[model samples]
Target chain A: MSEMTLVEAINLALARAMEDDPDVIVLGEDVGINGGVFRATAGLQTRFGSERVLDTPLAELLISGLCVGMAAQGLKPIGEIQFMGFLYPCIDQLVNHASRIRNRSQGRLTCPMVLRTPHGAGIRAPEHHSESTEAMLAHIPGLRVVIPSSPERAYGLLLAAIRDPDPVVFLEPTRIYRAAKGEVEDNGEALPLDVAFVLREGRDVTLISWGAMLKETMAAADALAVEGITAEVVDLATLKPYDEVTVLGSVAKTGRCVIVHEATRTGGFGAEIAALIAERSLTSLLAPVARITGYDTVIPMARLEQHMMPSVGRIVTAARKACQFS
Target chain B: MASKKMADGGLPVVARFEVRHRNYLAPDGSINRPLPAFASDANLLVSLYRAMVLLRSFDRKAVALQRTGRLGTYAVSLGQEAVSVGIASAMRSEDVLLPSYRDNGALLWRGVNPEEILLFWGGDERGNHFSGPVEDFPFCVPVGSQAPHAAGVGYAFKLRKEPRVAVCLFGDGATSKGDVYEAMNFAGVHKLPVVFVATNNQWAISVPLRLQTGCETLAQKAIAAGFIGEQVDGSDVVAVRAAAEEAVAAARDGQGPRFIEALAYRLGDHTTSDDASRYRQEAEVQARWREEPIARLRAFLVGQKMWSKAEEERLAAECHERVEAAVERYLATEPRRPETMFDHLYAELPEVYAAQRRELAGEGDV
Candidate 1:
């Protein structure tokens, strides 16, 4: 096991997947010689050769649509959308063609491609660069939206996403890309997907979060523990096919839940989890579910970004509110 | 006419480009150039004419079905039958076809059964699963989007060193979209085995070709992407087939991507829901009908003495019989259940979707 950052783990995953499968190709803007803007694909082009690692022109629509075609023609293409902001231009390809090809063809054709993009705000990226739009992508069917918060999870989940039979929108949180380091075993093992990971289990209340915001959520859990509050912290790795059983079971046992995310409060994935808890585990709830999320407005600029994003203090407050509810 | 380049001192001209147009058969059923060997064969020419006629019959029946409320809104190939048949007939069975919504004629000629095309436009998903050419894509309703997909397929072929080509068929308006330009650029840079066939049928829904771009011709657009682009008289099946055969052969031989702008006219409305009369003059439509592909091919066939009036009558009756049988089959099939909408949405429906699917069927616990 080697200690690596989230970005390094992602790079390792791509390298391992490429080494194992000759059909796996890496292509995107600046992904070849430049090693990607964030360097997530650093040294891949030289290691794997230009044939497998490609640096395409700055065309997101072509990049996304090309993967759909390649996937249908029996190539496992891993396409990168530089940032979550740049992904808008190619959403048509993902929504109209890539997502519908299998169903439209009645399983005659399937797009086994993985679209990777950095998401969420925290690195103080300019406008359109730091949007946390996983909820928007998760809304689409036939596309799995995954986010990895830690180095280990990033390595395993990215491998699983690449190997998934259907198209997967793997949203890498830019905030935690290199913010932390963890021991990652690059033994070519892929972790399970479509399930939530239980970080620190508690019985009083459940702190549900995923992606970058897992940082603040885990911190809040620690603070709550100092106050003698046992909080169950659940990390939702996959947003679309959410591990509802795990979340519902936690909420049922805890009888209180606080959902936190970096996206807007309105129509964020938090709302979906809240709704599910209310609908299924409502009777077991001793208190109302509280949501700690970004505002409805756009993710603000560098200075005000902190104000717009959900903070550790806010998560703690929401958790306290949930635990103290009548 | 030839274009001359002037020298500026010691500075040299960086690049030069020229667009070529091919027209083997004129509008009055006269030969413009020496016909290709395939065009010279009476049996091959008649088969090409027959395919175009069959598609025309299918188009007419589809429009009638939509008119009588028996089918959903349909896009008719109409005057552009030659473009589709030409490209389809020229393509080998192994070459994948990425067709737009209006390329029903091409799909039909590519061995997709008349019933399958009818079922697709008739609003059924099962029709997308064609019995022939398993690698071909379904009709892309969105404009200009399929080009990159074809490029990607071609990229795969090039990567595998396979002697296969991907044929992307679109309309004039698609050339205006950035996706088309990007696909062309990718194909050019990679030298992928792909052919982009833009059936420039003069209109993109309500927009005319003149409004689509200021580039003298849509064929010139490929030059900007660093590749060869050519134009062909789409009404002339011989020209279209010859151009497509050449282009497809070149791509399969690893000569990189080729772009062909086949000029035709949209004789029918964009769809049954659209009213072309609102946007264009009836005289223009009437004038375009004179250049319709089926009649043009038949005129050439008659001029060659290869197609007699009796043969025309027999072929027309046969086409009608085939179209009517497809219509009957489409009308007899049952619509998919509402709950089935959740099935194709994913390979295996997730638990949340499964609950929703059950809820749709009134069997949900939530």
Candidate 2:
């Protein structure tokens, strides 16, 4: 076990996978000599060779498209989309092509690679850098979506995703990449890609959150404890095949739920959770299932970002509303 | 199944059906008394003819497999066999081929296993993996998008100082796509050894060649991208072979990319499901069939006395047997389970996915 941050966890997983298979490779902008803007791929190129960790042209479509060719030729590539927002330029290749290659080829070809990027709004990133659009990617078939909340889960899940037979959209919350740290048990243990983790257990209200918002959800849950109301907190590490079993169980017990995320409320993952809760456990609801999410507007270029994006205050308010404080 | 395939997903299998006759031998089983305009040894012409017949026979079998519900809606290269085979035959084994969805003949000419080709188009992702002595790219389905890949492969050849040329094959409609122009420019700027062969069978699904672009020929489109464009009689296999040879040599010698347009008719339904009558006239089809490549070749060969009736019967029997055996072997294999849809993305299955996969396995229980 080793103490690390999400950045280190990803670095470790990349090292291990590349060491294990010659076919596994890494590439993107500034990933080479500069490591990366986040330093997530630091020291990899020197440890391996330049051929394995290349710095490619600024064409995201080509990056996504060429990776399809490389992966088809049996190379396991890890592609880094500079930012979640900037990934738009390559959606045709990623969505119309990459995500459907497996099905379109009738299972003949797949883009069995990983697309990793830093997302969320805490850092005052530019317009195309702060979006947390997991739902957009989760909607695509033939793709597994994951966003680890801690160093431990990041380490395990990264390994599991790297080794998975399907392509994965792995998003890391930039706010927590270095802000949070923890001991990763057994650097070799790989967390599977599809299950959610229960962070804490309680009763009255169920709090569902993931990625960078887990910390805020925990904070809000702890605040609700002072009011003599216990809350169950669940971190949805894997977003695509969300942990409905654990969530439904918690929601059933609590009779009320608050789905929280930094991403916008409209058509966000929070909506899906709310819909699922309404569809499956409507009678168990106390107040309407609440979604504490970002406003349905583009993230500003900083300064007033907190008001634009979701925060612990917003989550706590939503949790209190579900707890009948309204 | 056709409605189901269309109602839910993917690139449509062209459904237009029309057969323009392609005769390698007169009904009398003798080549016409005229000679082919271009010639090599009797053996090479026989080689091209035999390879083309193999693909033609294969196309027939593929359609039967689809009709029997054994295979999926297939995109047949039946009438385009001459262009596909003739172009590929002109190159060396070390040369790379980037073929579009309808170039099964190119795959066969490069020695791809019939099973591999069928398995690929038949709906197996693993079908595109590298195989055999020559490197054939997995099929390019999105129209004309693979042009850059061929250019890139050619660039790799240039970078490594290797002498092999890369040939990119597409249909006439592809000349309009931006990727083609981009690839042409890149090959020209880099002086990479790549040849662009556009099989002008003249329809992008329903839109005819006249509407695809205002240009007289797709080969001319290459000139705008700074490469030489040559137009040839697509039905004339001899012309296609000679044109391919020149393009391949030009690229191999670092003369950069050359575009060759082969004017041929799509002599059959685009695939088994198409009804060409919805668009093209039956009379027009018949007129084009008279200039069919196979018929032209057979006439030329008989005039030279290079081919005989006995050889023709022997080749046809050989082709039929080979296709028959391949079909039996392919169908004899067990059908794959649908769960394979989720298989093989990551090197190993991720934990989160296992829960979902298990939940899906239990269907309706949720």
- Compare the candidates by TM-score and give the number of the best one: 1
Q: In model 1, what is chain B's TM-score?
A: 0.96
> lDDT tens digits, residues A1-326, model 2?
77988899889888888898877879778888888889999999999977678776565655565555455444677888888887765566566566665555444555667888887888877667788888988887667789999998888898888787677788998999998899876547798667889898998899999999998899988998988879899998988767778888899999889888888778899888888888889987778888888888887778877887667778778878778744
lDDT of 1 by residue, A67-118 (tens): 9999999899999989999999889999998888998898999998999999
**DockQ computed for model 1 against the true two-chain complex using alpha carbons:** 0.84
- Computed on C-alphas against the true complex, the DockQ of each candidate is 0.84, 0.18
- The alpha-carbon lDDT assigned to residue A121 of candidate 1 equals 90
The true-structure Cα RMSD of candidate 1 reads 1.8
lDDT of 1 by residue, B6-70 (tens): 43454566667889989987777878889988977899889888888888788888888888988
Q: State candidate 1's TM-score.
A: 0.97
TM-score of each predicted structure versus truth: 0.97, 0.75
The weakest ten consecutive residues by lDDT in model 1 chain A span A317-326
Best by DockQ: 1
- Listed per model, the TM-scores of chain A against the true chain A are 0.99, 0.96
